[model samples]
Target: MNERDVPGWKNCDTMSGTTAGTTAVGTSGTQALDTREPGAGFGEMTRRWRDLTGESVPLPAFSAGTRAGLRGRFQATRLSDTLVVDFAADSAFRTAGTPVAGEDVVRLWIVRRGQWALGNSRTDNETTVSAGGFMLRHVGRLTHFATPPRTVAQVFVLPRTLMRERTVTGPAGTAELRLLVAHARMVRRTLSGLGPAGVEAARGTLLELARAVAGRRFDDQEPLLASPLAQAAKDLAAARLSDPDLSAAGLARELRVSLRTLQRAFSAQGESVTGHLREQRLEAARAALLTAAPGWSIADVAAHWQFADASHFSRAFRARYALTPTEYLRQQRELRAR
Candidate 1:
């Protein structure tokens, strides 16, 4: 309860009424107690979490089964520059609390064992996470989660500054409410790979996973460029661009729109759906070539961008950039050297 009582975990002088816990066993930093109960004593926790992560949201009840009797523990620790938190409960409970807005908390959770469901009021996104899957919480709006029976999860609470410094974009703001279901077996394997000495490695791997999920959502907004049907069709096409067999019929089937409707959607943009796909593919290919290493072969770069053949890739590259892939790479190197 008090700072002097808990050894290794001290009190942050700058943060009043908060306890700091540090471990010499691993990376060194501070751990602070912000809130214990789901609704009670959460002000400090909300303030500190928001300060570090820039996410604001209302803390919902731990569960709905108990009618708000069970209280969740809120503990935060700073490992080097990264922050970690743990929220646990052995019983089922729920609550209808006010929303916490404008705060972002990028959370990496390992549901050690048990089932949990997290719902976001703002995004209307509900995620049911099982024992093996990992959950990343992006805190910005009203969010809620509950577990059945004995549930334990280790949450890595990351600061916005640390994420930005690492060039890692996680589900922050409204984006955090989205649920990412990673491969359960792969997640278990990754966790197994993290022994006592592999904490840093584990942290990096988890961060990559979190960033990928968040980045995909961020990139997915391109489909909402126009409106109702047109944007939906465009989004579907973008999501399936890697599938070489993706066709206008397949896209129409996925979007549940008639071929005529799909055609009209693209016509509004003054281009056909097939034309858009070609343009996107060409743009992607150009980007891949531009970023390829100086010594990377033209064929390798072409393959990376999913070009059908080297000659076709060369023709498209020349048509678009007025230079072949080889010529472009050579010019880039010359510019860099100069």
Candidate 2:
């Protein structure tokens, strides 16, 4: 397809469509591609977009530093098999003329770099999202959103059947909204650091974020970590790692338990209760040293994780990993560069 063949092709809009309905919107300012026509700009752009997003829409306009000064509705013609995404950046776009609601698509809004507000009159619920926040609305649900000028958002329209296969769960009978500041930051960092190798990572991150917002706990929320007894023991041990007087006896007394009972729990994991505490503190110290960025001395990282002293931390780190912390970090960065 050639650029001229694109129905509403314009220099200010950049889109790539695959098959029929699958379209991807690019942030770069360029012309839409017409897959049905013979051309380079549009065809190449659309192909790349199709590769990025599994589902697509028709062509979409990419914002070119334009600002929406007042209340207005933005519309685009797009369709997809399982998902449709209407996206805009640097513009405040809203729905118009009471969109014909249907339960065919589950809608999600991701604030890429700005703030947004969305609500459903039918459900009497509203949500506001800043950068990294997401809002979900069920298919065929009547919804409204208002954003300040220069807001940027990507609207994802996914089918209910697609989400069902994933067994997503959340607040019953209400849309799930999540603030993912940390997750988003991590994803962006991974993307920046790894380049093309980060594509799979990005997909996994998106799915995990979706599941989390849907009220699903991934491995990060292990049941063991959430157990009251386990948490209390962990806290107590963490607080007294530096004191030689700190032992299972002290921990048991602090937790209102006998030493034997505490031992039983630790035994279940094949770990000595006091030994596990020491191991954790040492591991934390090692991690701090390995991850300390340039300009941070190895001694500083060891101190931050509360090592007994630099010499103690160095011996422990070498024994555990067969290398000093500084050497380990140097190797890690070299490996990443490759």
Candidate 3:
């Protein structure tokens, strides 16, 4: 089976050196790969699958019908810095568990129809995601997945750099996980109608929700008893901290709440909105300083995290951690060198 075998192929391959026949779905970096055709063999399907998803599915040693029985589609949409893939299938398949080069993505698989059998190669642990449940996996690691027939799911592919943890595993039905699933479904359902700004906001919301579920915390400073609206506002702020224009009023507008209402939500927790945002930015800048790459500087961290200037960032850093940004970076380097 080749490109000619599948109808309506749109050539959605965005990566370099992509073959010319496959097609995409949306205008803004959305790619959809289909293999629902009865005549489309597994070899072609698996090749396109690997191309689009960075995962490889080889023919099983014992199965002769694997080629003819496989049929599914992977629809991936790029949202700002992240990716969300919705998949549906009518057959069972297992991945080779090989790592893809230069792919630094963490996946949150939300199972809406069937179950997923996941194996962590490092720990030799097996986890299952049943219907209405989800599992988180870092694509950089070697992890095996066995998806049975009739499985329908959505995969939220978040950048590893955007996450604080490499991988975290836990039971399903966590409140954060539930919110993430609902939020993702809502974004995808209303995706087309959302213009540029709306798309950006949606991206931030989804990323925030995914991070909450994966990192196992919404905001470290957010009081456990904080109101739901306050927690949500924190999530949004954390997501858009890189924006220099982010403010309490902007947050209130995005959250569809009055400014006073939003302030009261934070006030009830004994915190002010502006103060909380500053704390979040300072913490984020500190994290960046600690993880500073080669050629990275304090000024870069300051500007990226939306500080007015290096001096202001230094003052804030000293106030929070009792050490200037340069001192903190040097201390972290010394510790790593040891």
Q: Highest lDDT: give the candidate number.
A: 3
Q: Which regions of candidate 3 are displaced past 4 Å? A: 1-39, 42-68, 73-75, 120-125, 141-143, 164-166, 170-172, 215-338
- CA lDDT, candidate 2, residue 4: 31
Candidate 2 local distance difference test against the native: 0.48
Better model by lDDT: candidate 2 vs candidate 3: 3
Better of 2 and 3 by TM-score: 3
Backbone clash total, candidate 1: 18
Cα RMSD (Å) between model 3 and the true structure? Answer: 19.7
lDDT per residue for candidate 1 within 172-252, as digits (tens), equals 222211212221122222432334434443344335435545454322232321223454455556666666777777766
TM-score against native, each model: 0.39, 0.37, 0.47
lDDT of each: 0.50, 0.48, 0.64
- Better-scoring candidate (lDDT), 1 or 3: 3
Deviation in Å, model 3, residue 259 alpha carbon: 18
Query: Which one wins by TM-score: 1 or 2?
Result: 1
> Candidate 3 has which clashing residue pairs, if any?
10-23, 11-22, 11-23, 12-23, 12-24
- Compose the digit string of candidate 2's lDDT tens values, residues 86-150: 34433354543243433355666667655766555423336677776555656454355556655
Per-residue lDDT of model 3, residues 1-338, tens digit only: 23343342344534332222333222222333333554445556555544554442222221334444554556665555566677776666566554444455677888888887777542343787888777776656545667788788877777676564455666555656655655555555565666666666666666677777777755533333135557667767877999978999997776555788778878988999999999999988888876768898889989999888899999989999999988887888899899
